[model samples]
Target: MADENGETRRQRNERFEFISPELQVPDGITHVWDWFWQLSGRRHSGPEALTFADVGEWSRLLGIEVLPEEVQMLMAMDDQYLRAVREDQRAARERAQQQ
Candidate 1:
């Protein structure tokens, strides 16, 4: 249900979406914690994880200045954006190391 502020719970769920294998929240906190750790340790994720700058570049690359929040939802399956963000981070680290 949408609140008076116009934000829906489902919309927020979209933001946390990940490219994880099917997961079922089990009935116990211990098992849930284990599952949570496993999921966090997963090497795979979607492009929605793109950095803010990379997201801007993605908008330029896509010929659409879509808002960051919107892109965050749209790139739910975007591996390219994820790669771009990672590369950007690596470059920044290398530059820092050089200095």
Candidate 2:
């Protein structure tokens, strides 16, 4: 992640891609997903409670790694490493204001 490191990035990407079709989950987990999503998204302005270790441990105790994304997500949540994605959502809206 230090500068434009392509080789390092590729290997990191491969770890999460190794999950098989059986590991993929359906839409049922969306409710829980949304809850975690909202919590991580508000890290800066929110109450600043519950470390990522807490969330990851809870997910682990439940013994569910049904999706590749879920595996990557829970792993990252253990270390506050979520938001690896640079979502252009709000950024896209802000850029349009200048145009």
- Candidate No. with top TM-score: 2
Local accuracy by lDDT, each model: 0.47, 0.49
> Looking at model 1, which ten-residue stretch has the lowest summed lDDT?
31-40
lDDT of 2 by residue, 1-99 (tens): 221334333354466585333334448766455646554654563234446564565557766444557555544553453243233234435767979
| Native RMSD of candidate 2 (Å) | 12.9
Could you tell me the C-alpha RMSD of candidate 1 in Å? 18.5
TM-score of each candidate? 0.26, 0.27
Candidate 1 residue spans exceeding 4 A from truth: 1-77
What does candidate 1's lDDT look like per residue over 1-99, in tens digits? 233356444554566673434546446434324422333333344323434465465447656545445544434424443564566558657968999
Tell me how far the alpha carbon of residue 21 in candidate 1 is from the true structure, in angstroms, after superposition.
Answer: 34
Q: Where does model 2 exceed 4 Å of error?
A: 1-25, 45-50, 53-83, 86-99
RMSD of each: 18.5, 12.9
Candidate 1: give the clashing pairs: none
Output the TM-score of candidate 2. 0.27
